[model samples]
Target chain A: MPRYKITFAYDGTKFAGFQIQPHQRTIEQTLKTVVNRMAKDPDPAIPVIGSGRTDAGVHALNQVAHFDFPFDIPERSMVRALNSQLPLDIVVKKAEIVPKTFHARYNAHKKRYRYRVKQGEFVDPFRRNYTAHYKYPVDIAKMQQAAQDLVGTHDFTSFVASGSQAKSNVRTIYEAKVYHDEALDEIVFEFVGNGFLYNQVRIMVALLLEIGNGQRPLNDVKRVIAAKDRQQARMTAPASGLYLVDVSYDE
Target chain B: MPRYKITFAYDGTKFAGFQIQPHQRTIEQTLKTVVNRMAKDPDPAIPVIGSGRTDAGVHALNQVAHFDFPFDIPERSMVRALNSQLPLDIVVKKAEIVPKTFHARYNAHKKRYRYRVKQGEFVDPFRRNYTAHYKYPVDIAKMQQAAQDLVGTHDFTSFVASGSQAKSNVRTIYEAKVYHDEALDEIVFEFVGNGFLYNQVRIMVALLLEIGNGQRPLNDVKRVIAAKDRQQARMTAPASGLYLVDVSYDE
Candidate 1:
C-alpha cells in the first residue's frame, strides 16, 4: 500500500461537519466513500484522516488529508479520479505520494485560521454565507492592540468551548493579527498557532469584537486569558465566517 | 394606492429565474411572497414588477422593482419589513415611495451588466457559483480591442437569441470595456446600454472570448453585426457568471 497526501478546499455551507455520522454527509466520509469506490475493495476501506475537524458552515482554503491506497497509482491520475467523482463543492488542489510513516494530524506543526466579520448594519445577501455580520461600530485600533496579548504560549482554557476533548489546554500562538479589508468592508482576523481547541478561534473573535465595541476594557483579553475559565469569554462567533486557511507539516 | 420602489440584491444560485413560474422557486415569486405576506391581502396580490428578467443562476447587485400597496408605509419601514421576512439570499437595499405612474420595467433608461471569467485551469470551489471558468489561454489586449466595436448604437440581430420578444434589435451601447482583476484572477467584461435584447450581453461576451482565444478574426464583431444573423454568433456565456449590476431611470 502507498500513502498519499492531498491538499484540498471545500465550501462547507452544505456539509454537516468534517467527521462522519451515520446518516449525515461529512467531509471525511465523503472522501472515504470516493476513495473506496476507486479502490474497488471494501473489506478494509481506505481511511481519510484530516488535520482537524471543522464545524458545520466553516470553510477551508487549504485542508490537508492523508489516505493509504491498496495499490499504487500516479498522483496526477489519483487527483483527477478523486475530483471527477467528488461534488462541485469540493476540490483537490494537489496530491503526492508520501512516506508510510507520515500522519496528517500528528505530523502537523502549525495551522493558520481566518475569521471574517462584515462591518455594517445591513447584511449583504451575496456575503451572508461567507461573513459574520456585525451591526455595531468597531474600533480597529483597539482590536489590533488587544490582539497583541494573544501572542506567545499560554493556557487558553478560557477560549475553549465545553465540547473540546483535548487533553491539554495550553497552546502556543505564534501570531495573532486583526486588520480591515477596505475593499470588502470586512475585518479579518488571522491566527497561526501550534493548534486550537474546539471553538477557541470563534470565542476569541467574539471577545475581540466586544473589546472593539467598548463593551469591555481594552485589556480584557489579558484578564480573560488569566482567568482560564470559559465563562469569562461568553460569546462564540458564528461558524460561517471561519476558514481553516492552511496546515503545515515538518517535511 | 401608493406605489413603492425598491432596490434589492439576490444570490441567484438557488433560484429558477427572476420570473414567476408554476412550481419553481423564482426571485420575483419569492419577493412577492414576502410582500404579500406582509400586506395581509389576498385578492389581487401585490404585483412585484422587476426592471427585467434575469436567467437562472444570474445574480443582481442592485435590481429595481415596484409594487402598489393598498396602504402607505414609510420607505425605511418598508425596506426593513421586506428584508426582515425575505430569505437570507435576498436583501432589500433601498425603498422609496413613487408616483402611481412610475413603472419599474418600461421607465428604465440605462442598464449595466457584468460578466466574470476566471483565468485558471482548475475550478475553485468557493468561486464556482460566481465565476465562469476558462481553461484555455486568452489574450486580454485582443479582447479589449475587439470590445471597442460594440460601443455604438447598432442592430444586434447577430447577438439576440431565439427567445427574445423585443420588436426591434436596435440598442444603444454607451460603454464596453474589458479589464483584468489581478487579485481575483478574473477578466471582467462590463457593458452599459440603453437596453439589451434577450441573451445579447452573454452572446457578445462569448464572441469576445472567442476572439481573445484567437479563434476568430479581430474584425469579426463588426462583420457579425453587419450580417444581422443569429448564426454569426454561436455562443452564449453561462448565466452563472452574468450579473445585473445596475439599472438607471430618468427621474
Candidate 2:
C-alpha cells in the first residue's frame, strides 16, 4: 500500500464539515467517493484522516489529509481526476507520496486558523457567505489587547463548548492576534496553536467582540480563562466566518 | 420625481442578466420589485437602468444604476432597507440623490472588467463557481504580450460573437492586461474600455488563452483583429469567471 498526502481547499458553506457522517454531505465523503470511483475499486474503504475537524459552514484554505491506496496512481493525475468528479465547492489542490508513517492528524506539528468579520453598514455580497457580518461598531485596539491575553498555555475549559467530550482542556496557544483591514472593511483574528479545545477559537472571538463592543473590559478574557468554567466565556461566534487556514507537519 | 444613483453588487449566478425580460430573473427585476413594494403603490412603475448588461453567471463588484422615485427617501436608509428585503446575493452598497441629468447607461465614462482563471491541477472548491479552471500549462508572459496587443482603438468585429445585434463593432479599449498570482494559483485578466461590443471581452480572453497555451503566436492576435470576422476568434470563454468590476462616470 502507498500513502499519499493531499492538500485541498473548500468553501464549507454547503458542507456539513470535514468528516464524513452517514447520509450527510461532507468534504471527506465527497473526496473519498471520487477517489474510489477513479481507482476503480469496488470496496474503496479508503480511510482519510484530516488535520482537524472543522465545524459546519467553516472553510479551509490549506487543509491536509492522508489516505492509503492498494495500487499506484500518479499524484497529478489523481488531483485532476478527483477535481473533475468533486462538486464545485471542494477542490483537491496537490498530492504527493509520503512515507508510510505519515498521518495527517497525528503527525501535525501546528495548526493556524483565521476568523474574518466584516465591520460596516454594507456587507460585501460576494463575500457574505464566507465572512461574518458584524454590523455593529468594534474597537480594534481593544480587541487586539484582549487577543493578546489569550496567547499562552492554559487550561481552556472556559473556552470549550459545553458538549465537548475531551478528557483534558489544556492547550498551548503560541499566538493570537487581531487586526483590521480598512481597504476591505474586515477584521481578522488569527490563532496559531498546538491544539485547541472545541469551539475555542469562536469563544475567544466572542470574548474579544464583547470587549470591542464595550460589553466587557479588555482584561475579562484573562479572568474567564482563570475561571475554568464554560459559563464564564462569552457566546461562540458563528462558524461561517471561521477558516482552517493551514496545518504544518515535521518531515 | 427624484433621481438616485445606486452602486450595487450581485452574485449573478441566479440572475438571467442585468436586463428584465418577460419571465426571467434579472438584477433589474429584483431591484424593481423591492422599489415597487416600498413605494406602496399598486402599480408602481419604477424602472432601473444599469450601466451595462452583464451575462448570466457573471458577477459584479461595483455596478451602478439609476431609478426615479416620486417620494423622498433617505438615501442611506433606503439602501439599508432595500438590502434587508433583497436576497443575500444582491447588495446595495451605496445610494445617493443625483441630478436629474444623471443616467447610469448614458453618462458612464468607462467600465472595467475582470476575468479570473485558475491554472492549476487543484481548483479551490470555494472559488470554483466564480473562477474558470484551466488545467494545462499557461505561459503568462505570452498571455500578457497578447493582451497588450489588444489595447487601444480597434474594429473588434473579430472579437464579437456570432449573432450579436450590435450595429457597430468599433470600440475603444483603453487597457487589457493579464497577470498571474502564484500564491493564489490564479490568473486575472483585467480590461478597461470606453464600451464593449457583444461578447468582446470573452472572445479576447479565448484568444489570449490560445496564445498562452501555445496554440497561437503572440502576434497572431493582431492578425485575428484585422480579419474582422466573428469566426476568426478562438472560443467564447465561460461566463463564470467574468466580472463587471467597476463603472466610472464624469462628475
Candidate 3:
C-alpha cells in the first residue's frame, strides 16, 4: 500500500460539496470511486481525505488531498492516469508519493481563501460562475477598514454559520485584505488563517461588502466578533464567490 | 422599422452554428426568438444577419451582426434587454441603431480570426472548452515562418474547404502571426484578412500546426496555395479552437 498526495482544481459549480453525502456528488467520493476503478481488485472502502470541506458551489484553486491505494505507481504516470479518468470540471493538477506520516486533514496547519466579486454595471456571463455579481458601487477604503478590524486572534462565533459546533470558536487570521483589479472591474478579498469555521469566510465577505456598500458600518465587524452571536452577521455570501486556494503544513 | 448593429460574444459549445439550421439551435435563431418576444407587436419574420457564419462549436469575442425590428429601442436599454433574455453562453455585448444601408454581411471589409492550441503534457480542464489540445512539442519559429508564408494576396483555393462556391479565391492577409503565452502554456494564431473562404481559417491553422509539429515542411504552405487544390491541405482544425474576433468596415 502507498499513500499519494494530490493537488487539484475544480470549477465547483455543479458539485454538492467536498464531502460525501447520500446520492450526491462530492470530491471525496469521486476520488475514491476513481481510484478504486484504477485498482486491479477494487476496494469499496478505500480511504480518501481532503484538507477540509468546501460547501456546494465553492471552488478550489489548489486543494490538497491524499488517498492510500494498494498499488505501486510512478508519480508522473499517476497524474496522467487519474486525469484521464476524471471529469473535466474536476482536475488533478499534480500527484506525488508522500510519507505515510502526512494526513491531509489532521496535519494541515493553515488554509487560504479568496473571494471574488464583480462590481460593474454589466456582468460578463463568462465570469458568472466564478465571481459574485455585486452591481452596486463599493468604497474600497471602507472594505479595507472592516477587514483590518477583523484581523487577529478572536472568537469568530458570529462569523461562523449557525450549525457549526467546533470545540472552540477562537481562530487566528494572519492576513486579510481587499484589492480592486481595475482591468477586470473585480474586487478580490483574500484571507489567510490558521483555520475557519463552516461558512465563516463567506459571512465575513458578505459583511465587508455590505460595509463597502454603505449598508453597514465599518465597526460592525468588531462588534460582531465581540458579541459572539451568529445572528449578528446575517449576510452569507454566495458559495460561487469563495475559493479554497491553498493548504499549508507546519513544515 | 429600425436596423440595429450588434456586437456579441458566445461560448458556442452548445450552439449548432451562427446560422439557423433544421432541428438545431443557433445564435441567429436564438436572437430572433428573443427580439420577437421583446417587440410590442411581435414579428416572427424579422431579418437577422451575421457578418459571417461560424461553424459549430466555434466561439466569438467580437462578432458583428445586424437586425431589423418593428419597434424602436435605445441602444443601452436594448443591450440590457437582450442580455436579460439570452442564454448565458450567448451574450449580446453591445447594440445600436444603424443606417438602413448598413448590412452586417455585405458591408464588412475585414474579419479577424483567432485560434488557440494547448501544447503540454496535461491539459487544464478549465481551458477545455476554449482551446484545442495538441499535446506535442511545437517549433515556434517554424510556425511563425509558415504564418509569414501564408500571408499577402494569393489564390487560397488550397486552404478553403472543398464545398465552398466562392467566385474567387484571391484574398489578402494583412497580418498573420503565432504567439506563445508562457503563463498559459498556449499558442495563439491570429489572422487579419480582408475575407476568408469557407473553412479557410481552420484549414490554414491545421496546416500551420502541422508545420509547427514538424510533420510538414516550411514551403508546403506556398506549394499548396500555388497548387490551388483543397486536397493539398487536408487537415481542418476542430471548431472548438476557432474564434471570430473582430469585424471591420471601410466607413
Give the proportion of true interface contacts each model preserves, from 0 to 1. Answer: 0.69, 0.79, 0.31
Q: Please, what are the lDDT tens digits per residue for candidate 2 over residues B81-138?
A: 8898899889998899999999999999899999999865565566776888787888
Summarize candidate 3's per-residue lDDT along A1-251 as a digit string, tens digits.
88999999987888998999999998888887888888854645677799999999999989999988788999989988998988878888888899999899999999999999987666666577788988898898889878998789999989888778788999999999999866566899999999999999999999998999999887888888989888889989899889999999867
Task: Return whichever of 1 and 3 wins on DockQ.
Answer: 1
TM-score of chain B of 3: 0.95
Model 2: runs farther than 4 Å from truth? A74-77, A96-102, A107-109, A180-185, A249-251, B21-24, B135-145, B179-186
Between candidates 2 and 3, the one scoring higher on TM-score is: 3
Order by lDDT, highest first = 1, 3, 2
Ranking by TM-score: 1, 3, 2
lDDT of 1 at B188: 95
TM-score of chain A of 3: 0.96
Tell me the spans in candidate 1 whose CA falls farther than 4 Å from its real position: none
lDDT of each: 0.92, 0.86, 0.88
Which pairs of residues collide in model 3? none
Give the winner by lDDT: 1
Off by over 4 Å in 3: A162-167, A181-185, B41-43, B162-168, B182-185
Give the top-scoring candidate (TM-score). Answer: 1
